[model samples]
Target: MSGQRKNPQARDRTIGAQLKALRQEQTTLNLEAAARAIGWSTATLSRIENGKRHITSEDVAMVLTTYGVPMAQREELIESARTGVQAGWWSRPLPGVLPDVGTLASYEASARAITDWSFSFIPGLLQTERYAAGLMSEDGAEPLEVTMRWRARLQRQRVLPTIDYTAFLHESALQQPFGGVDALREQLSHLVQASTRGLGVRIVRGRVPHRLLLHPWLLLDFPDAPPVLNVELNGSSVFLHDDEVRSYDNMRSMLDGMALSSAESRSMIGQLRERL
Candidate 1:
């Protein structure tokens, strides 16, 4: 039980177990029968019950309604699903890291495509090792911990070659040196190299008039799943779903249209490197 408590996936599975129990108490329906009644696949139902997938409100409603749950019981199950979706191991704290780091890591690992807009700093996936280390060090992290964090960050970059990564970076982020001239140079060079390797890189020139019209945000898209939007503040992160993603999608397109083309972006970055 203790071991299960320590694993987020296991904890989610337990919620699925509860949902399964509710269904069982309501009827003698077998998995196939119940799944067919709800218009879902047996495999999907099985995955939900096994805690392999997150149960949404729609899923809860379908299952409870299919089992002929009473209004009162139905409301209870709906609320349970709401609470269950929010429960995850990343909500806990780890020494020298933000509470939301685990959750962020999990989402990134599962994401099929990532689109982000940055104004102040370079996106983590695009940061070079030295640039990442220098930025982490400036945050007051100890050397050893910064090294570990950099390693973890670098590992996350492995997803780039295999996944679709579209980054819309504000021109100011390119102009402002994060870790000194040399570090920024390497970072820009790295960005150009990555673009050559097939990553979608767009630069939103700061000189563009009316550029401050929209707020900075990050948008993530998953395969066969709903998109998620994220905004990071000084010490915390906020995750948004569904309608919010739709809004960001519009904003992302606007930014993309305003950005320099891939070739032009590389040339701009190269010019910046020359200035250094």
Candidate 2:
């Protein structure tokens, strides 16, 4: 395990666990107490505990010593801090992406399966370049920023081969003229093709009469770490971990139950395109 690299999600989870355990067990040092003793803020420590920020070996050493952890535990955590954080490619230089979106990219890179439910426009991973640009621009992101985000989204699509992806696109999403009629047609045609190539592009064929989770979200299942839910908001996103993710799981089962088969989904897309 020394040289073996874990997925970003698994690595972060392991590192966060080690740090959290050290803080909890070495006396009753709660988050605020430990943060003050280590000369950091509670928010910063909370990020560390939640695995939202990457910590260095020195950071690990300093926190452990402040908590009076044993030498052996300190060394183990320091070693983990050294190799546990995998680099995030989308995070480089930070031009077109929101901070939380970069976090989404990292999770997608390491997921074993992605079960998505979209009530609005198309899911990012399945979107074409023009469709993505249109949506981003319509949302008021700058032109160059739209290109950067679109390219990054295409890069994410390239990772589709490595995971099992099931996107449950509501029927209304197919009706969106995202980049005008031409772009929407092209995008739907692309989806039809993608379905044949290991992508489970299913259609939930009608308006959802009742809404429980009104927005779009996805469940990213890591090969090692437990599943997490990725929910996109108006300007930000949040990850629902552990038991909080179960609601999305239930939602997924419900959607799948309501979904059309892959073949039928492709047929539905074709039928919609003909009316355009």
Candidate 3:
């Protein structure tokens, strides 16, 4: 399973909405005429206007210019496009991990609300520094590189204290020994501490078998946009939007229902720490 979601459709729709509004300003410029003037396929223009596909910077510029937008107005649209295409901080390449980690990290940083569900391990944002180092070490990360990744992970966790976060972990994730007994113990303790500090931490008991087990996913909801479902993978991440968000949202609700309450979850983490 993966943990990153980039909803292309949401981005596309935003651009499309702008295009449609601009086109409506002039009655003479119909869809076909606008498409022709921009030297783009009518179908492609239709999809863009319908919010089905992403509109590139060039496409935005061409359409705005074709619509006879004043120089001042054109500058504003171009500026918007530039912001839209600008690479996020997470898009920077990590030494060993995929380069796209930066892109996902950027999304996480800007997101208003984050809901994550994990089955095998603690989500990166919740990982303790020691646990993060151990996990990266096991993945064969270089010693120095492991430290860098751990720092990155810790930075990601800072968001929890500053933003709204809800995390659901399977019982197996809590019980599993990520690095060693000491590491797992510390990790559990960290979770308990985080819970007390306002992060929502819930654990789904192994005994509660449910359909949500079919796909463990993370759903990220932004302040001014639709939610995104991140399909985690070992090597690459896939982002799902629109219809996929609905499915993940349903599963998230079911999983949340089966998971322990916040207070109980804190107690459970404490109990696990004692055993460790």
Candidate 4:
């Protein structure tokens, strides 16, 4: 643990999941019962299980001892909890930017794959600087905050090459010139070039039934932990985990069946750029 580095947030997530599994499988106690046995409040235990609270090696030992887990398994989990924490840029968030942006970046940093389903705008990872600034301006962001947010966005986009990235975008999003016609054309051109790289640029054609689509959401899958679904709202966001992520998985499957292939999407984008 001395020489190795780890993201504390991701470490907590994997540790928490493993502990939750241990509790359910090795013991008959429910969450409430387990908390009582460990002399911890239910809320604290629940937060630990959900990876919303910081946990220490001692905390892992206490829970495992209370559950009568075998010493070998207990040692393994405690060792994992002992890993050193490394702070990321998200630790000190950019002033005036939405706080949830940091949390989203943290998750993105640890994701093995990411799927973005958007209906009204280009996904942030796929947006150009001008296009992103235009969006911030339209939403009434102050000029300074807009600059800070896009700088943060540029940092987040660095993970695109490291993970399996895909964006399922509706045709209408391409038609809206948020940053004016020239910027829009440049954005479309960027998308075309991105498809030539490894990015998955699947286009969801317009006029599809409304029931088949939903508001924008990002699903991030981890190598060891459960998948997380991030649904953005006005000035805030919600992260869904475990069973709650199933619906989004189904939605992704549907989109996969309907979206145009990368080649087709590239051609469509080129055609749209020409029409512009």
Residue 74 Cα positional deviation in candidate 2, in Å, after optimal superposition: 5.8
Candidate 4 residue pairs that clash: none
> Candidate 3's residue-wise lDDT over 29-129, tens digit each?
88888888888778978877765555666667888878888889878877776676544434455565454455456556667888988887898888887
lDDT of 2 by residue, 1-276 (tens): 123322234457657667787778767888898899889899978876776566667777888888888898789878876764545565463576675666677778878999888877899989998888888888888988988787777777877998999999988888898878999999898898889886999998656746534788889987766688888888777888877888778888888889999999999999888888
> Candidate 1 vs candidate 4: which has greater TM-score?
4
Ranking by lDDT: 4, 2, 3, 1
Task: Give me the runs in candidate 3 sitting further than 4 Å from their true place.
Answer: 1-17, 20-37, 40-59, 69-73, 83-88, 140-145, 208-211
**Alpha-carbon deviation at 172 in model 1, angstroms:** 0.6
Q: Which is superior by TM-score, 1 or 3?
A: 3
Per-residue CA lDDT of candidate 4, range 1-276, in tens?
Answer: 123322236567878888899999999999999999898899978878887666778888889999899999889888877762444687677888776787788889989999998888898999998988898899889899999999899989999999999999999889888888888999999999999997999999967656445568999999988898989776678888789999889988999999999999999999999999
Please, what are the lDDT tens digits per residue for candidate 1 over residues 197-232?
889888887564354334456677766455667776
- What are the per-model numbers of colliding residue pairs? 0, 0, 7, 0
What's the best-to-worst order under TM-score? 4, 2, 3, 1
Q: Estimated TM-score per prediction?
A: 0.67, 0.80, 0.79, 0.86
Two-way lDDT contest, 1 vs 4, winner: 4
Candidate 1 ranges with C-alpha deviation above 4 Å: 1-95, 207-216
